[model samples]
Target: NSVSEYTKLQKEISSKRQSLYTLVESGSGNLTKTAIDKINAIRAEMSALEIKKDKAYKRLKIAKDAYADKIRSIKREELGQFDGRFVPELAIPAGTRYLANIILECKSYFGGPIEMNVWRGVAAYNCGLGRTKEWNGLPYIRETVLYTRDILYNLTRMLELKYAYSTGDSDLIAKTKRKMGV
Candidate 1:
């Protein structure tokens, strides 16, 4: 049985308190010694089980946290060195479009003949500001697009992390399982 089962059993055993009291009243020293020994043994076993449980939980949490931190650091490094170059002219600030050209530029790059979202996300991340709010108001045409793409890409990655952790994404869960050799 598991720890919980053992715990319940301990409780049930202890519920014989009335009998123990009567035994004590009758001066039964042998029964008292046996009861005390059994209780101590159960407690020791429970303590060991709890310690093992704590260690396992800590190990899993540390492994997952380290993985997440590494991914974020990679994104930050890419965003720090981005340079926007392939942005479309319509996506430029001078264009008549109501919506900022950067968003369109990002869409173009995303849906364009070349399906390189990761590379574009990396470029966007590297060329643009780390913060997404910096992309507002069509700051630098190319720069904004780069930042926008990078932010979107990172958001997707974040969602993937949540999905994997919650077991909401089977593929991600499978990948994690493979990584952990589970």
Candidate 2:
């Protein structure tokens, strides 16, 4: 059943992909969105395992960042703008560092509470500083909106876990861990 279902979804995605260019060219606003969403839904269903794995990876990243206190916010004097060069193919750490720097810069530019700044900075990171500022927070684009929402949710969860740890609340710790799927 699943194999057939997967094949069925694949065919659906293929057909949607075929129409996507036509939809774009014709400027069929809502129809284009409908087709894109349908294709994405099928892809998402197929990528469920990948989503789980990605969450696990995010948890590991959080743990690594916390355990080492490895990446303090880059100093204000040192936050440099991206030079539009060096897109490191295999250097994840380097790429993360670059993204983190952009976030720090965006936070400083936004000039609010640290937490809010981080949130805004992340939105800017996904979209762009100019776009995020123009929208006066998160842009209306679906991908950026979801990306920012997920990051904020993860950050909140991380804070809750830290509180649980600090307060010696085993029950909260266990509950949070369960929520975190780890």
Candidate 3:
């Protein structure tokens, strides 16, 4: 399935990124010409894999949308709102759209919401410490950890603000208040 392929490609990308980080941190001056050549090769391969991943994602999304449209058509017919040739556009709210993308990106690595939060926390901790540290008790590179932390933090903050405004949830509001030390 495309999902499994996407997951594999994501892992490959992560590995390649870590490898690239290691090479940069280790200093090219100490590396043999062959090692430098290998690094360039890895970089090129990573770029190609990224392009492949994007194509795979597009295919997956199209498949999902087709299935959803079919289900929606059936429901609309049952509700007496269907026309033979008309399909409604998929109109997701901006906040929900942003959150969905974040979930997808995280799920490629971390799976569900709770696991995603744990991953975020680990990244933040590593970033703040200014060194590579254990994530889920496994070593991760510092640069990637910091990048992941920023993405998670910004996405989480955006979702929290959106949900707090729309739902007026006391827990969300209180969490924000505590963050601001109110």
Candidate 4:
């Protein structure tokens, strides 16, 4: 459930940091009114995200506590204490289901070959539907481009692994698992 939330927060932080850096760099000597305004806006966005991150951290702590409590309640031996490196997110599922729904939505809104629509949806998830529509496909943003590429590449590998499993070839399964780092 929190997978997308974490990813979104991380992307926003990177975007904001990059924007701030570019604005400051471009303003080298004289900071124009426009540049100052944009910098302020970026700072405001960063502040908002900081608050969001704080809330998310609190939620993470709550999740950790709940997980520990559940573990303690088990009838088996006491697990003792959890390490600082321990995270409850390991038990959480990925946002694949939500992203799948978004892909379907994109297909409905932007009708095209399912393959093209899937790319559009993936890009939309990285950026936004509005941005994707404006670009008529994936936006030129570097982060979005890489995000889409990585996701699609992983998905392709997943499909290949699935097919390998269906084939029931132990050799193929072993090779696929090794390739996928499974």
Which candidate gets the maximum lDDT versus the true structure?
A: 4
Location of the lowest summed lDDT over 10 successive residues in candidate 4: 83-92
Who wins the TM-score comparison?
Answer: 4
> For residues 1-182, could you state the per-residue lDDT of candidate 1 as single tens digits?
24345444434333343344444567655556776776566566656655665565566567656654654466533643433221233234443242234345554644653333334433444434222224332223343456656666675766666679897778888886575465
Model 4 ranges off by over 4 Å: 1-97
Model 4 scores a TM of 0.47
lDDT of 2 by residue, 1-182 (tens): 33344434444444444454455566545556676686576556546634554555566666655633422344433324322222223345765786687677766777766666777777788768887788787766555778989988888888988988998989989988998897
Q: Rank the candidates by lDDT, best first.
A: 4, 2, 3, 1
lDDT of each: 0.49, 0.64, 0.63, 0.76
> Cα RMSD (Å) per model?
26.6, 13.2, 10.9, 8.7
**Please, what is the TM-score per model?**
0.23, 0.45, 0.46, 0.47
Candidate 4 Cα lDDT to native: 0.76
Candidate ranking under TM-score, highest first, comes to: 4, 3, 2, 1
Candidate 1: C-alpha lDDT: 0.49
Flag regions of model 2 displaced more than 4 Å. 1-90, 179-182
The candidate, 1 or 2, that scores higher on lDDT is: 2
Clashes of each: 7, 0, 0, 0
Clashing residue pairs, backbone N/CA/C < 3 A, model 4: none
Lowest summed lDDT window (length 10), candidate 3: 129-138
Candidate 1's displacement at residue 94, Å, is: 42
* Model 3, TM vs. native: 0.46
